[model samples]
Target: MPNTSRRTSKRDLTLVAVLVVAAIGLITYLVVSPPGGDDGAAQQPAGPSGPSASQSEGSAGADESPLSGLARRDEGDPTALGPVDAPVTMVMYSDYRCPFCAKFSRDIEPELIDRYVDSGQLRIEWRDFPIFGEQSEMAARAGRAAAEQGRFWEYNRAIYEDSPERGHPDLTREVLLDYAHEVGMPDMETFTADLDDPSLDEPVREDLRQGSSIGVSSTPTFVINGEPILGAQPLDTFVEVIEGAAGQQ
Candidate 1:
């Protein structure tokens, strides 16, 4: 008879290789599609979904990660928080009308600011990915307008804190103007003018394009360092990921 033992060993090795490929595929699916599934929010076509091999490793070097380049790290960016050179940078792709985004903003963001941002370990950058509808875009433009007047964060807080516990809010133009006033925007005249300014729309569109190109189909998606964290995950989850990324740096 043939060498039966050698044949079995070869078969085992082949099975192992297949299993490895399948595992990678599953992880890619999880990272791209996320848990809640598509809610028909994506207005643009999604690109390929899957992080590079380095993204799965907590200790992976930033230079080796394709996603790390996403962090703008612009110190002068009005919508961003924390230092430009913070050890860990999180690029948050969020929509104004997303309830889950509001939840994170109201509940977890303050803690993050106190624990990590204040300590100079983390930088959070905001990208206005308005996927909900027309009002969503309007709200996004309003945020940019608020940013111009140095009240972006305050406006952000007003919107999120006042949002309903579930579903999208009615972010009408009048409502947005009211929020601008409520946030104590220094120049309501300029803020109002900026809201109707067509140029302000480009930044919002660019943010949405950037997010869509990276397979972000939903709001509140985050790219922490090089790793993608989908949905409004628990605060502990953020801590773990942020700490892990900090450790790598």
Candidate 2:
């Protein structure tokens, strides 16, 4: 983790709490977004250590080698998102509103879980990058609320799996709570209260500020060591980045 020095303001924390809840709403948008999140909420892809998203577009040649020779398929954490204790730490700045974040979580997170996180070789950290959309904040808060019940992964996964479903609904507190109920989480009242806990606000703001310093401008921007890997890429890209990071230690 990076060193902490900056202090957050009251407004920032307030925004943090709201963003968490809006994350749920963002997931709802995913259900109605185009495949691969290419229009509207999906913006231009940024450059990477290798080829940029622009380099592989328009011609329709396909990027089969995007992450070639990058990672070995492996089993990851079935029930967790962050790392337990990894020598290499991979940090992600993601907005629930960004369909790309949904894609990355669905496609790449599993490989990280199977090969590195589950094996204790790498520790992965996710920082909310809600992008301050209409309801992005809510979705993030919803995830945090679920985290209080040790069911963050379940809620996050549920959102991804349903990203392609028909119809849409605002990701309200009731909806998040409902998902919690479906996932067999603990008491709803207790977890729901944690969502409003003033003490929890600081961490969320701190994450936002820290991510800004590293040039992250969108969802699913990743940093391995001091290098940046921007965009929602294939799992193999993650493998290359993660393995390089793990080898550093």
Candidate 3:
């Protein structure tokens, strides 16, 4: 009977090992070759690593993986949603000009906020990983300007919700200001002045460098509790990953 029990335990251990290996392999494949090809999100060539976002922020432990350290749970972060200490932290790297990003913002983000963020189970930190062009950088700066007025998320929703469904909308300076006005930004003067502020450029640059260092080659890339979910996947995929991360905690 003891021999039988030992054999059963060994079999269980072997099964668990195989499952872990398979999961790792799948994640690696997804990272190396993102799904949905070109129509999914704005892509960029992976560049050499710069100063890691975690190292500069001093938010990660020596033992923690770079992916896990991506979450900046700064309570004062105006662009962030949910409690700083939530069990699951999802660090999102996105470009404002990406159509796929607009889709995620329009469809999936609201539901995520309602289900996980409102319930205090998840924290989402936004990173501006603009890869489109000059307009993309401008939009990212505009987002920072909105954050100064405590209306970052409002501005975010306005930009994405108003975006065209088929392709990237031309995010001109006038258009960005229009969105700001649409979101009822109280001091348009201050918002306008803040848009081209050189200081705002650093944060955007930092986020871009951070994303590049982490092998984020596309917009709408998400790092949920150390696991990467590239592109705007289905709602069920997000739910499953979020739940799995929550259960592990």
How much lDDT does candidate 3 score?
0.78
Model 3 lDDT tens row, 1-249 = 999888867855653454355445436644664332341111221232222444334423444444665565666789899998899989898889877789899999999999999999999989998877899999999999999999999999889987776556799999999999999998999999998798998888878767665566666788898788767789999999999999987
Clashing pairs in 3: none
The digit string of per-residue lDDT tens for model 2 on 33-151 reads 33333441132222221123443352123322221111111124222344444556566787665556677778778877888777878766667767746466777777777776678
lDDT of 1 by residue, 142-241 (tens): 9999999899999999999999766679999999999998989999999999989999997787787777656666667888976777767899999999
- The TM-scores, one per candidate, come to 0.77, 0.62, 0.76
Number of residue pairs clashing in candidate 1, backbone atoms closer than 3 angstroms, sequence gap of 3 or more or interchain: 0
Model 1 per-residue lDDT at 166: 63
Local accuracy by lDDT, each model: 0.78, 0.57, 0.78
lDDT of 1 at 34: 36
Judging by lDDT, tell me the better candidate of 2 and 3.
Answer: 3
TM-score of 3: 0.76
